[model samples]
Target: MAGLTVAALGVVGFLGYQAAATAPDHPTQARPGSHASQSKEKDKDRGRQKKKSTALPAASGTGERVVYALDDKRVWLVGADGKATRTFEVGPSPASPDPGTYAVTSRNEGGVGSDGVQVEHVVVFHSEGGVVFGFSAAVDGSMPDPNARKRTGAVRESRADGSALWEFAEVGTKVVVIP
Candidate 1:
């Protein structure tokens, strides 16, 4: 009788071990209320806010027409009829020779020995065909020195497709547009 009892206990232990080892890794049943449902609710709230902010009025040409972006980083050519004709990305602003023109300089001083290298100075001629010219200058601000300025010959004619039509070296001061 004692031997039979011992045998029965050993069989029960082996069955428990086998069940644990062969069980699925994940839980068979999910919790009553999971975080997955809560996350979906939060996403819906964010979507509503985004929709409200981008709710622009219909193309009505009768209201006050303006050609500026909300962030002021980009300018749009809006007709008096309240229609946006063209849009251009305008970077930061600085002093310029031409009135209403602006200049923006993008520099990186973090890299090794990058203190002397200036990335690019984009001078945008807003009035004249909305021309945007790019130039690499020194960190000392010697090349595009707004003070002792010379018109770097049209580096290239501004194209609608953002391509350089022509390029001339650092020529004289005045940009002579040859027709």
Candidate 2:
């Protein structure tokens, strides 16, 4: 029994050392629901309680598709009637796509983002110049820092929003990026 216990301790110690050595120098904190509520409160306190407009950018083509505005950091799921069915704010990827129209090229149900966060509902649209732009949601419902630079090219959204986008955008669905 004593020898077995010693062997287990040795294995545990080695594993701990390996984990410590592999840890990142800087770890990110997940943005929680409370933080969002606080942000809303701050916006109200500053008298900026105006509702987010659902209007699509004028130059974005009228179609049944997803429209993303780089300047606004917002997305609109437009219906066949050329009206926005849903709109939500999102975090920009390390690299954004140039203003243009693209089609949903591929999709992965879930995966680890290059930044090491587990995300779901990945909807990819454009890939070129060493950057692939897509949409995903953190599995924990946490958000990465918008101001901090991320390693991957993913427009992070809330889980609910991500699911909506994943459902609305299928292979060959139109995607428009507007500056």
TM-score of 2: 0.68
Q: Which pairs of residues have clashing backbones in candidate 1?
A: 61-81, 151-173
Question: Tens digit of lDDT per residue, candidate 2, span 28-128?
Answer: 35365677567756868655422533567778897798999887788999999999889998988667788999999999999997667899999999888
Flag regions of model 2 displaced more than 4 Å: 1-53, 147-151
TM values, all candidates: 0.23, 0.68
Model 2 gets an lDDT of 0.84
Model 2 residue 142 CA deviation in Å: 2.7
Best by lDDT: 2
lDDT of 1: 0.34
Clashing pairs in 2: none
Query: Across residues 1-179, which tens digit of lDDT does each residue of candidate 1 receive?
Result: 99999999999999988887668663244354667556656879877864553333343223323222223223333444555455443322233223222323222222211123233322222233333333233323333332323333122112331221112112221221111
Q: Any runs in candidate 1 off by more than 4 Å, and if so which? A: 1-34, 57-78, 84-179
TM-score winner: 2
